[model samples]
Target: MKTEQLINALVADIGPRRSFLRSFVYATASGVAFDAVVFFAAIGPRPDIAAAAETWRFLFKFVVTLALAVPATTLAYRLAAPAMWRRCRFEVLMVPLCLLLAATAFELDLVPPSLWMVRLVGSNSVNCMTLIPVLALAPLTCFLILLRSGASCDPGLTGAVAGLAAGAIAATFYALNCFDDSPLFVITWYPIAMSTTAAGGYYGGRRFLTW
Candidate 1:
């Protein structure tokens, strides 16, 4: 079969059920990576995740970061799959749900758009705004890739795992874009970015999770 045909078929298989899962995973994983930009940036190169646990403020944000996932996921679930909400999986819900959190975080002034840009050298953040593009770009691409590849994971676990991976990718890109090279910058500004990604994930989840 032609690759294009294969992808179209895969999209069909993903159907409504898998579509929601894929979006959720991609968005959520991006959240963690975005959160880490500041986490590691504040600590600078070679941050000891264990040793860096002393500061109460940073720690609070860390907890809040994960904690925010729940409400964010819930919000996405409400918006996307309110009727058949139980059909939504955590991992699948992770992407858009976290994306929503990122959006909210940005609006709330939680994190930078991504890596800080000294002179706007091609950078971006994860948030509601980003979700718009994801809606346009990610699904079709992801669906096609999954289709051509002819690989599938359990929507529940696969989506969650994928989300964490995607979140990390987002974080890496974010750090690169903002690369301010300052402990203060990470500590002070990183959370905002994290929040933005979280919001995007959440909002996406809200709309996508509408099973």
Candidate 2:
């Protein structure tokens, strides 16, 4: 083919870029709404939600999960682009992690050292581990769909961040129903559940996100 013809063909293939961040936000919102409906229908908030809301411990769970979700989502959108910014998006993830760690440390100092293990174990370790990922299913699927709309440099990483966002949002939903408000419990099990979904996203992205 002539050089001019090749240039014109390539130009024809180029199209206006879609906004990954906006698409992801819409997808995440849809997933959250779906989860909310399911939650209210089958798994309403804890019976003592009114009372629990008054406590800082109860509020802390939402705050931490939200904090994690925001930055992680931002990073996910960034990863969708071809040229990555040099900024350390991963470092932003540490802010919430360190906050939870600090809260856990404070709680340990205040409570009986002997009961530390009990707090860590909490009452619903099994449930938290199971439900967070279960609840994350819809959101993770939505995030993956959104991720596919973009030209991500690393599909696996993009998917993993999407999983993290899904898990964080799911955990936030679960916290309303969970009776265990201890920082120790939040610090431990939340990450495990998020990690499970993140791994799933990574593999799914690798298998399906290629052009």
Candidate 3:
């Protein structure tokens, strides 16, 4: 075809672009609501809600998860666009990591060296790992479905970010019932669980997100 003809055809094919932000909002909302229902149904909030709420450690958990979720959601939305990779500033994602690291360092300084392992391993390591992924399933599926409506040049990366968002959302819900609030626990196990979901999203994207 002639260059001009091809250009015209391409322009003609360009209908209304899907709104990444809108789709993400709907998917995340649905996922969060689902997580909430599952959480209240199976494992309600920590029994000592009043006591837990008073502690800085408990509150920080929300901060960490929200930190990951908000930026990841933004990044995921941008990544849905073919040329948006350059526009994404990942430094924002580092905020939560730095906060967690600072918190961990403070915790280490206050606690004995021998006890560091105890904090890292926390009581619900297995449960955290298990539940985060399980909770993420609904959100991840929703995110993948919504993402399919966009033009993702880097499907793997987009999916990974979507997974991060899903995992963060799941972790947020899980935090309500989880008794462990140590920075060490959040830094270590949380990432592992989130990474697992991200990996799942990456592979799922490769298999299902192709345009």
Task: State each model's CA lDDT, in order.
Answer: 0.39, 0.86, 0.88
The window of 10 residues in a row where model 2 has the poorest summed lDDT is: 12-21
Q: Provide the clashing-pair count of each candidate structure.
A: 58, 0, 0
Writing each residue's lDDT as its tens digit, candidate 3 over 18-81 gives 4456667888889889988998898788889889999999999999999999999888888888
Instruction: Give a tens-digit lDDT track for model 1, residues 49-136.
Output: 3544454433443343344345444333333333444554555435434543554455346437564343122222333134322322
Q: TM-score, each model?
A: 0.30, 0.89, 0.89
Q: 1 or 3: which has the higher TM-score? A: 3
Q: Cα RMSD (Å) between model 1 and the true structure?
A: 13.5
- Pairs in clash, predicted candidate 2: none
In candidate 1 the C-alpha lDDT for residue 155 amounts to 32
Cα error, candidate 2, residue 193 (Å): 0.9
Question: Which candidate would rank higher by lDDT, 1 or 3?
Answer: 3
TM-score of predicted structure 3? 0.89
Report per-prediction Cα RMSD to one decimal: 13.5, 4.1, 3.8
What ranking of all candidate models by lDDT puts the best one first?
Answer: 3, 2, 1
